[model samples]
Target: MPRGKARTAATARKPRAPNLPAPFVNGTILKDLRKKEWKLGDEVGKGGFGLIYLAAEDVDSPVAQTAEHVIKIEPHSNGPLFCELHFYQRVSKPEMINAWANSRKLKYLGVPKYITHGNHTRGNENFRFLVMPRFGTDLQKIFEGCGKQFSKETVLALGLRMVDALEYLHENGYVHADIKASNILLGFDNKQEQQDQVYLVDYGLVLKYSPDGSHKEYKEDPRKAHDGTIEFTSTDAHKGVAPSRRGDMEILAFCMLQWLCGKLPWEDKLLDKNYVADSKIRYMEDIPALMRACFSKGESHGEISKFLTLILKLGYEEKPDYNKYKTLFKDGLKKLGVKDEWKLHLPVAGTSAKKSVKRKSEEASECSTPKKKVRGTPKVATTSGSLQHTPKPAAKPRQGTPQTARGTPQRARGRGTPQTARGRGTPRTGTPRATASRASIKSPMKGDSVNSPQTIKSPAKVQTVKSPVKSPSKGNNSKPSTRRKVKRSRAKKVDAWVQTSPR
Candidate 1:
């Protein structure tokens, strides 16, 4: 782990109850959270780190009738508010808040607007709290409402907006170490335009990637691996390196991939860090296979593959070309013939929905058919944890002692049976010879004669023997002789034959 960069897992430790106050009751007066005292209403949310309450201005305040806000209270000793405070303060700066928003034509950069922050003592407990404008439910809630997956168009739009948010953060030298659907909040309004507006919240895991204008170098530390959410964390993060610009983009790629596919490759291995890392590497090595595994065939997944590839190519200290990615999604929308509109009714019959219908119909047809009964010898059960099986003895020959392949009567051999031929003239009649299994057979020598019983040959052995042809001297530049060419051709045929033959 880098010096001064070690972070405990979010919510790993809870504040001692004696040092933290119990949940505030409705109408409890909170002092200094805003211009005047604010009254706590109902408990809105609770998390591993803290509790959130619906807060409104106290009756005496001039803006008492204003819209309600949310107050997040945490134990002063341990909570995410300290880290989040820094991010909110930086982003809320007048010149920085909308620096890129206008140019991008986004309604707003998706950060929760900061209201106020302060510390308070409730009876024996001292606590830290932050007040911010309370928005609608997070994307996780919406994802559940819409089923587990989002359409490609919806995911693309979300990706573009998140890229912008990350760009703003990177330009200011910060990175959102935690970027997941639950941290993203949908716009509060019921209107379609507002519904499409997405905000990136939860900055408790935020870290400065390039503090003092110097980018953080990549470092590999096993202890630090699995720093963030296991399912979507970047490979660099898995190596325990401090999160960087590339790490942010990599996390975003995971998010978009999950939203499109309904699950991530590492979701099943959430508790196993090493397995998740290995699975990520394997999937990345074959992105096309990854797409096919996650999505139905014939879907336009090339764009996502390209997007993920771009992130994979980025170096730890390198800044991403945000405009290039933004343009990529923009051009994708145009190619899909989607109009220049961010808010519109989604088609009831989408690609994913259609594929879902097809799958259900196929499943129904399969269920409607009856399965055929298989009649044959039952398979033998093997002992668990052992690969070897004891061979069952062959059945004796039927009826009146038939003649063996070697012209011997079956009964002539005492306490012995006939052995099968090895693609040869005759079978042996005696105690079975200890012939090598075909899989264990070695290549026959050139002088060995297959017709003779002593020189039984296996199908073909693929030994990677070097060609006997010798190159002419470098300075001579002479062509090979006819004899050498003939030898080379023969060698090629033997090589091909060896590879094609059954083991």
Candidate 2:
């Protein structure tokens, strides 16, 4: 990891968490690389499974060289360890999607190049493992750096590719159950490619599908226990339904749309919290129609809501025969009446999408390495002392209200929140939370066809009341005012509240 207080301070402000091994120190694994140790270098990252070390070296003398490669580790399991192993072996299959993107089959599936995989055993326990060429940082880090919003052209460009990738996997026979910002990697745009690329990373929960597109349990262990990152898991995934193309699409939509709306579908305050809470665990198709209805007003979302509805429909309904809706999806964007924006080709950029591009050849020599520079080693990040994780405080629980830990209310809205309609059930103190006025936002800036005037730069503003503050007294109080309000006459009200344990 890079050394400095800069990274330390940055991580503290970011609420970032890097998985640390419980039993083993990374130094032990560094020792195993011995001659290769000089080439590998120190630990770049560590996770629940194991450690990811940088290994930059020459073909002849691997250990004693500059940074060259990366090794990801899954430390030994303490007890039953079937799911993790099954998942790793399944997705890491030489002929699987990941492998196809590598040298074996020669498809640029936008995945990293695979290295080698192995594990170490201690006493009665066995540790499963794998390795890959580590490059620039993953998207989670990039998104944190970029913050909650992305420009339209940037989003459209990225959105089309990710969806296309998901569609491709579904067509082949696999489901990448875990799709989150962390699993997407971003760095140099290969010089030969159109621009910077966002390759899919971390196939931790990837599983295979039968020829009929149905799931076949892995012989290693298929108890329906294995799933994916909770933040990205689809309703079907949460319900123990086997991962499917639809589920994968749901995850893809979640990953892309989160950048736009900055809220989860099931967490919307527009509906009864009870329904969402219960429904959040069902399949996408099982989501209540009312939830879809809430999105009926495209005006409220500025066209973004319509795209999200499509994603929700894709997640819940049957996969649209791409053949049937390919042009229709394109037309929907056109119908939005967005002007000056180029049609981002669904499979690639419009140019690549329309042209008949040949698949990459299998010979590694035939294909030149992308000219884009690979990301350098990341500064090692461990939990810092200044930052603390906190959940929302429970709202003063109403006599009949259910409460989440911490005193914050769940889905409580009204005059001051999204859930409440003009103080109806809202507490006296729960005044509607004010939001950014459209007038205050910088008017649409002119740009290339890729970027449009209606661009979102941060997570859509969401308001959550941590605790109602007593209006400050003019004479008896000495505490400085803690509330802040910025009003704009033209924008719609957006409510968002974040919980943080004071530093």
Query: 393, model 2: CA deviation in Å?
Result: 45
Best by TM-score: 1
lDDT of 2 by residue, 1-503 (tens): 11111111111122124344444442344323223432344677765455666554343443422354566655454221234345434444445665445543322455544445555665665554455655555655545444444444445545555665566556556667887777766533332222355667666556665645555532211223224655566555444456767667666656655654445565554234224424444423433443344344432333334444555555332554543333433444555554423332222223322232323343443454432222211110111110112211111113223221111122221112222221333233222222112211222223312122122232333222322333232453435434333233112232221121112
Question: TM-scores for all candidates?
Answer: 0.64, 0.46
Residue-wise lDDT of candidate 1 within 1-503, one digit each (tens)? 22233333343332234333477876677776454677777787775578888777654543332345778888877646788887788775545576667876776787777777877788888877788877766787666555568877787788888987899888878899789989887665432225667789888789998777788777666656677777888777766788988889988988888988888867886776677877776777678878877876557776788998888677778889998898888777777676753642232324455677788999987876653212121231121111113222111211211321232222122222232222223333122211112111334445543432213343432222112222232344446475355445445554554565544
Give the residue spans of candidate 2 off by over 4 A: 1-39, 57-66, 78-107, 121-126, 187-195, 211-227, 265-503
